[model samples]
Target: MTRRLLALSILLCPLLAACSLEPLINHQVVDYFEANDIASNQVILQNILRAKDGAPLHFSELASIRGSLSNGASVSTTFPFMAPDHATTLPRKLGTVGMTITSSPSFDIDSLDTQDFTNGVMRPITPETAQFFLNEGIDYRMVLLLLVSGLRSGGRPEMLLNAPNSSRVVCYHELPALNALPTQYSILEADEPCDGQSEPEFYAFLRTINHLGRLYPLSVPQPPKPVGRPFDLDMTKALTAVASIDPGRYSLARLASGQYQLMSAAHGSYVILCRETPDGPAVAGVLTSERDESTPVPVDACSRKHGNAADQHASGDPAGAAQPMMMIGEQKNTVVFKLRSTLEVIQYVGQILALQQDETEANPQLPERCVTLEYENYKGGNMTCNFGVLFHLQRAGPAFSSPLNAVSYNGVSWSLPAPKVCRAPTRCDHTLETISVISLLLNQNKSSKDIAKTQAVQVVP
Candidate 1:
């Protein structure tokens, strides 16, 4: 009986080795990825197998078996010792294994269009393209998942991928390079601005690719919905108010009721008050000389034609030459300019303040109903007069309030409910004018540096 059993074991050994060869090969591949700390590669292999065969083979399951075998706790480890003849049989079976592997498929990496995987530029991967990568032994599914994660995470793939050129495969070799780079992927967090890309636009593009369902088999998670603003203020009035003032000379704040508050750029300067009147929302304040004494006002030739005191003075008219005087008390107490409509204010202020002196020369007629000032004289007597009496506040034309449409000025479109202020009132410590000046200086400096760098590069050649 013992001789018969030994003879039977010899015959059955080769068959048993053949049966165990496939699992051993799979275990070795899983061990290689895990030992090398290549989790991405391991995932790719599992995914490929899952795609080819309907069975889901997890690396963790293989890892657990490997752990048991290494600790001498698994019964399968003794199979090799029980049948030494199986080892001789394995060498002959390798050819069959190689044939099976080669028969799976070979991918043409060179055939893939270089443009499809370029960083920053999003393009859909065709089903054929994905299959080609898979055939090349590239885990295209893993590649797609990592790509979507990097993009959604807000990391610039250009920075991460570091391909030699736009037209190149973002390879498995390149995947390890990301570990050295900063993990941040969101465009918003990047110091350099992306071409006005928002998070929503990026996710929308991802969703488009996901719907194609060729690159990645699984569905990508949807991005969170953006929060909406609670209220929309009439930005026309605020924007008009801001544009009318010399940019650095004034600051604006939106009130809770959607009205705006204007204040002088000077620290501790009182708010430029606005009142709701029967005429409309009118600004109640006095236009006082910034200086205590009269200074040499630079009046242009066109302004002199307006016959205002400042213009006369500049043109050598004796009456104009007489130093423009103001009541000491009334100097501090200016007039109320009524708000007709936010758009109309710009036209009204432009004419009344001689901002459009050229237009004043063409048709010089002061409006009868221009801005009015009401204040007490030096003798403490109440008085009221048009701002035109003191300064050349010319009228442009009929009020612009009639045909209400969008107002475009200085390259900004001021819509009815003003676009939300870029900075909240509490955060806007610096006057808009000051911020504009700083921004201009910074931009000019950047432009100068860029020019200098370009010149240097050219000169080096």
Candidate 2:
């Protein structure tokens, strides 16, 4: 028996020696990190819930987590070489083999529930930030509809076309005429009707964000970085400089042979998406036909040069003139559009949630602003819905879908459906991408990844 026990210990020594806990420890740490991410998403959703319930929004952040794991193994064996030949009590063998593992994890949490943090989150987003997100490749509709409060024409904030109820229906057929209307049209004589409420135009704006975005994207047209010193630039200089490049492009000066060369610069704000014509370059209202696919000409400025119908034009103000038009505002000028802050945007989502919850199958308090969306009952049809439709939260039964994000609030689970499973509010898998993108947007920072790197756990291998 003594020899057997010694042999068993010897045999187990190699097994114990080959087992290194580093990989296991690393995996534990990574799991902890993923837990924090999951919790963070829950926090974002919970705050959105607060907004929905009209409760003031609050936030908390996981500062860090420290975890330790301890492992122990035991082995034992016993055998009676032979049953007791004469013993009344059996000499049958009993052996034990056992292993034990234990873990303890600690967390450091921080609260952003303070006044300063709340204020920062609630502060209006700047034009620079709006432009930055646009550059980030967020869907143009998301950028415009969520962040933008409304158009700023003639220095007045006009939310002439903003309405939707979690239902993201768009009127693609109507966008061209909608985009063609001057920015000042909201303030001007109002030919197309600016009653501060128009269902068709709202859906039109939401429907065709792709071309509409290109036709009327936000711009912070910075003056070209001077190669040397700045020079007084005129309308003619702007036009002449860009002459050699293309009609729908901007102009800049490049150093050449000890002199500045006038040429078209790709960095222009408004571009006239035009189609070639025998009569001349007619201004295209929007990218509608195959002919409208012509290379868009960049318009440097909206200068008045009335003459032949050869000049290109763009999507706003006095839309056409003999020279290329900047086409930014009510009077053919650029203006700083407004963007909502993080808190405000979340509040809007809350409002939509509250509305969706309160709305009924019988009465259905949906506004006329959702007219275009009402055309939805058809499948295998054109895409009339907006990204919001892709962002769905279920008050019940999210567990079945394996929700992408979910949280326990007031003893109930609120979940945004896994894009992989519950495709859209329609509860079918269409595309499984945008809901994750929603999380990405919420976690956006002026510098997100860099800040994450600074916060990363330093694992010295």
Candidate 3:
């Protein structure tokens, strides 16, 4: 019996040793295989999440991937795996973790109660609040999620749940599910993947507004006007001023009945004939010519000629022909003056006709005035003069007859109009009018429905 037991023990010892050795060898092999696989895949995953320079992938790129996965959009990508000594190889397949992105129901921002939020414990979501969350190391994506949730949930205030104990915050969308369970749903990190069963969906609405606010942190939405329709224009109380004159440089002067002159440099003068209207003042007519008097010759030449003739007349002449000569000279001067004055009137008329013909179409608001002057000298000397329109003025004030002043050529004296006051009780603000004009122009290109939709979606801070 002792000999039989010893023989059995000897057989059992070999079997036990074989069992232990087999398990040890298998574990070492499995560990080595897993370590190599992880090393290769780590490079691929890092490349997918970040660029070679370490910057995180852009949202658009990530969105494109998400869209392709959801919509089955054809996507082909190659990830290079780096090996020792700059050797590279492509990864056959990458393992994917389960992720689900679902859309939540739409809600109106206006319906939110902005005054009472978070049971009056915390303030509503604002730029300041958003910044506070960012400073606390909250990712922009999570911050946006909270803000959008608050905006959708009637401006409810958001708080960090289990913050002191755990750095996680409860998502409003998961509140209904969390309430039913003993455990609370919380976000552990900004980039924490959504667990389809536990976390389910991520709220993604108002994406454009969220992106704009987050990326351009300095930009804030402006509050809409308290009263008055956008781009409203009341022509009755609209500000009016002479169009052709620059209010900054020239002053308006009432030269005659129904005729107003902008006193500036003689070359820079503007003439406007205004008629009182229910809409302030309307320009009845505009003066197209400069106030100028022409002599037979240049003014200096005429003066010199007159002085010479006077001196000759005063000098004693033996023949009485000197008197006839003086008389002839006087006649010549009179004829030259008459001719010059007639030519000036003709030139003025021609300028008005040219302006009416749209010769200055190149510049619509301020047209170029072309004037030609022909001076005929009785002494067989003639000259031609050409000039362009000078004054370029923009409207300045609400009152049409407001005192507009202009600098003289000497820059010392100013041409001023009679004291005129605006009797209209209400006048359009120039700044507001400008904005209205631009808004009107932009709205003209959009349909009424489109305009309404845009206004509804506009976010005002």
In model 1, which runs have C-alpha deviations exceeding 4 angstroms?
1-3, 19-23, 31-113, 119-121, 124-461
Q: lDDT, candidate 3, residue 378?
A: 11
Evaluate model 2: give its lDDT. Answer: 0.45
lDDT of 3 by residue, 1-461 (tens): 95466556555554454444455445544544444333322222222223222343211110000111111112233344664364484455432223232322221212112232212212222334334444554333333322322111111222222111122323333433211211224334545654532321221222211222222121111111111112333335643645555744544433213233333322222121223334543222111111212111111121122122111111223122211121111221111000111112122222223332333454444434221111112112111111211111122333433322322222222222222332321221122121222233223333333222111122111
Best by TM-score: 2
lDDT of each: 0.26, 0.45, 0.26
Q: Best to worst by lDDT, what's the order?
A: 2, 1, 3
Q: Candidate 1's residue-wise lDDT over 1-461, tens digit each?
A: 95476556655655554554556556654554444333222332222224223343222211211222110111111122353463555422111111121112111112111232121012222223322323443233222322222221111223222111112222221211211222223323324354432232222222222222222121111111112222344665556644676735544433344433443343221112222335543222211112222112212111222222221211232342333322211222122111122112112223322322332344434323211111112122111122212112111233422112123333433222112242332122112222222122222222221211111111110
TM-score attained by model 1: 0.14
Estimate candidate 1's alpha-carbon lDDT, on a 0 to 1 scale.
0.26
For model 2, name the residue pairs that clash: 168-386, 248-297, 248-298, 249-298
Distance from true location, Cα of 347 in model 3, Å: 87
lDDT of 2 at 456: 44
Which structure among the candidates has the greatest lDDT?
Answer: 2
Q: Poorest 10 consecutive residues of model 1 by lDDT?
A: 452-461
Residue 113 local lDDT, model 1: 17
